[model samples]
Target: MKGCAFNVIIQLRELFNVEGQTVKIDDTVSAEELSALGGYEQYASDMRLLGKIANRAGVVTLSYAVSVTLRHLCDRCSEEFEREYGYELTHTLVTSLEDDGGEYEEDYILCPENALDLTELALSDLRLSLPTKILCREDCKGLCPECGKNLNEGGCDCGK
Candidate 1:
């Protein structure tokens, strides 16, 4: 459940109005404190949300799908690689005249109009799915301390 005083329901019309209503998620999650894994960094480059609105059980349910880019540092080699953000998780809010539905199913919600913090939600997905160990490349050769060379480039004096 989203820990907030109230969740916002983004108007489907407004979201759809944009070229894709794809907002960046990199600015959503807070990552000041994270574990150091295999000497690399993990982050979300660009996370975006896209979806529509529909009525379910007489309540306005916002349907959404989000995507973003995940940057990881190679665990074996200190290299950086990027993975497209597939934050396709949809969230719903319940804003109604009475009986505020604290829970929902299938990304459904009840809102006053049709508005949501697309930015926040998208960021949330990005934060939740961030890789703990970032890899620059699946088969990165890392740095050669003996000569400071990228092993993936071939020919390292560090002795293969």
Candidate 2:
């Protein structure tokens, strides 16, 4: 893969060499380029991935936690706010998949040529974990439909 701030390639050859071995990973993924993803204009900080890859009883697995602070506009009130999000992700690792016609494809992560781009995997997982509708708080009152006033602040003169 082309070298970049978020590209974290892990060599699986060494990990597979010894059974019951674990590899720790702690890295940051740059968020500047992710602004084009839509919804949010920027991130408060880079995404952090902390976890380990282990070969347990011949089954290789990757487990990690990703955390990041995002700057977003609350969908309800249209107020700008910063929120921290955390996601715990786990996946089974495999060097190759049996030809089952892609039946169980999504069950495992394929590390082609014994190389896995962890940052890419983590980013994908993070995106999937995000909420479809983002709100500053759980019980956001939202804005007044008639007056275009933020209800979270106070009620507007426009009744109903």
Candidate 3:
């Protein structure tokens, strides 16, 4: 079976003995791959990932900012529009069970194989940052229920 495209692995061999070392990350993730992550309706062709990863002993710290254009439906007016969003994410990676008290933690990734996969980690952060409701404008008049006409565009013939 093939692995997910977003599952980019990072080898830990070079960081074992290193401490306080930071690795800069600059990469682009396709919207197709991001859509597979399954939280939003539509995404731009590509999203930019920029940030750093710091290694200290067996523990690693991952911090990065993601920027992308999102296509959303306005809840009030029912119009489709595009919006730009940028946010930062941080995660802790541990290489051993003892590092996380012999159990899984939501905020930390367990990398027992001496490698870390960033696909799910990044997706979770992005979804959490998304707003529950998206609007094209603050004062959207919505659609006239009786006439089924967009009120924001113009008034409907329906009384009241």
Comparison by lDDT, 1 against 2, better one: 2
lDDT preference between candidates 1 and 3, better one: 3
Error of 3 at 50 (Å): 0.8
Best by lDDT: 2
Which ranges of candidate 2 are over 4 A from the true structure? 1-5, 33-41, 99-107
lDDT of each: 0.50, 0.80, 0.75
Local accuracy of candidate 1 as per-residue lDDT tens digits, 77-116:
6666677756455554555434544433545434455456
**RMSD of model 2 against the true structure:** 2.9
Model 2 scores a TM of: 0.83
TM-score of each: 0.50, 0.83, 0.79
lDDT digits (tens) for residues 20-76 of candidate 2: 899998987767644434433467888888999999977888998988888889989
How many backbone collisions does model 3 have?
0
Candidate 1, run of 10 with poorest lDDT = 30-39
Largest TM-score belongs to which candidate? 2
Query: What is the descending TM-score order?
Result: 2, 3, 1
Worst window of 10 by summed lDDT in candidate 2: 32-41
Clashing pairs in 2: none
